[model samples]
Target: MAQTVSFMAVGRFEVREQTAANAGVHMTSTSPHREPIRVGVVGLSASGGWAATAHVPALAGLDGYELRALSASSAESARAAGEKYAVPLAFASAEELARSEEVDLVVVTVKVPHHLELIRPALEAGKMVFSEWPLGADLAQAEELADLAHRRGVLTAVGLQARSAPPLRYLRDLVAEGYVGRVLSTSMLGSGWIGGATYDDNYAYVLDITSGATLLSIPFGHSVDALTMVLGEFRAVSALIENLRPEVTNITSGEVAAKSAEDQIAVTGVLESGAVAAMHFRGGTSRATAFHWEINGTEGDLVVKADRAQWWYGGTQLYGARGEEGALTELPVPARYQRSLKQWTERSADPACSVAHEYALLRDQITGGLAPDTHGVPDFRHAVRLHGLLDRIRGAARVGRKVTLTEQGS
Candidate 1:
């Protein structure tokens, strides 16, 4: 029988066969042969937020990983987070955690501004790293990190979680199979009113380009990453953005805040594959507008309605519809994984569901050592390319012109 326990200690979670004492702290075997990877998570504060909710639970639930250590900026918070999440070891700082021999994989889920600070230390320690996306605050940062990893022959996986979404996978396969016919154009509409929690310190850094919370960096990143994967690399893009959410509650503190990061972003671009895409990220309304996207092609049209992805510690559900002629065809995630996916999905889990899938997929990749085509884990190569595109978008917004991507010979 599956054991169920619900708690509000750190983040809300109800796991079967685990307690608050073991929730994110321990791992059990799904198969007798599955060897668990001992992982130490640094940045348990807001930056390590996903590690608590997604990585910690995801790793614990699976037969693959054992959560050994939890770290914060200080030993006190680290101990607090470790106790709260049930991690056995708590470190005062990330540097100390990285050096521990028990930590095979050092997962760095830190703030964008502190990404380099934490990740560099882990890489230098010769541990595999699974950091969050935009990989770095900018192209230069990304390049620097990638260069270090390349030099050391260390394994790295960025938080580009959408790559593992079944719906996204379906879309990519459909396009390759010519189900969507010749893709002609793609448009994505994703926006909703920002809650008071939307303006917390976790996101303030984004407002400052140096902090890495640029519109072209995050919200724009979520949809664009999925769009590009299903479609192809972009060639040129023209865009603009607006700061609509002037005020928000501290996402972490629950206090109202002054926000300047653009609430909406406007963009149009053509992929090297010749498919055109127009995307919008908005956050000024009272109503929440879920992810709404459509692709027009010669064979047929594919449309994705609101919220195709979901994440819950209990598990994850991918929900999306494939359409041709404006009618629904197939739904993959919510239907397929509905049994394993948890019910709390409609809330915090949705934003990071795609990312969660990538972790499971990449965990399998590293098991085989570094090799090409391992569970479709993308290397620094793709991350560098993504950073370049982001640079173009940021630069375009500054220059008020279309930024073109450099096309390299295949």
Candidate 2:
């Protein structure tokens, strides 16, 4: 019989341990022999946010995981979200959710600035934690959280969900399977859609570099993460980061805001496999190409294009040409690449698609079905490494020189 823990937020908070039948909590599990991993989401709001848009739908569509609890900024909001999402429990803060025995996994979906505070409690409680991208506001915070998670021996996952995307996974396999036969060079150009000449009042924080949610860290960070996954880590890199748009108009209130976050980022690096890599990311949508990437090799070439830089969302198309081929032809990602999420292919444009895939990988990881080291899910340690790389990029840009990974303590 599966054990189900129940919680009642009566004025304060109370926990009661019981079976599903006795607690009157309906347990939904895809596997009859195994219980679902109960998940508590921090920052789930009734008004709708990334957590509502992505994580709610993701957990809803997947098995072996249940959206059990949620925490909002206030008790009223938490209760509202609980009722809206049909979650069994709700809390006013992340610490309450983290300390709950009912929640086997605590997912931190808040902003970058609050990531350290939200994640620290979960790690301290020895609960499995899944934090969104960037991991922290900067390298120091990420390193600190990673160190704490390590000390706690907790299972951790970061929201580098592009690694779980079907197309990206297929692309990685193709490159590994010698589809492009010893890649000689790769180039990518993208538009971040933020840090542009216009901004939304709600997203004004992105214009501040101190927020750590800049164009370079959000869009470029996600895109580059996928790039490194397909290819390999950078052995050395030279970068140029510039703030082309110093002022941006607020689309909502028509007020002008001074922007410090960079609008342009250029990076050139050597991959661990000795392949040359170059990437250029600019703010705002482009009339010509929003996103384009090409990999050239001795025997063949592959190209990936999307309607926008955020390939993880949708419109990611793959094309390739080899040896005697006269033209590049579209290469459809095979069904096998979708794994258990083949049903979600049609909904690839939805933000929940890749998130669902990531949740599935996390489920596998937690259920002992997937080895921690072998699974493609980026953990806290991986986040720390990526954060360090971003630091190196900033350092290189500041010094106007090339930075070697080994010399920079990679």
lDDT of 1 by residue, 294-338 (tens): 887876777666542121111222222334234465544444422
lDDT of 2 by residue, 29-111 (tens): 11122677889999999999899999998889888888999999999999999999999999999989988988888899888
Query: What TM-scores do the predictions have?
Result: 0.77, 0.90
Give the whole-model CA lDDT for all candidates, comma-separated.
0.63, 0.82
- Quality of model 1 by C-alpha lDDT: 0.63
Candidate 2 lDDT at 51 equals 96
Off by over 4 Å in 1: 1-34, 45-48, 192-203, 244-260, 284-288, 307-326, 333-355, 369-375, 408-410
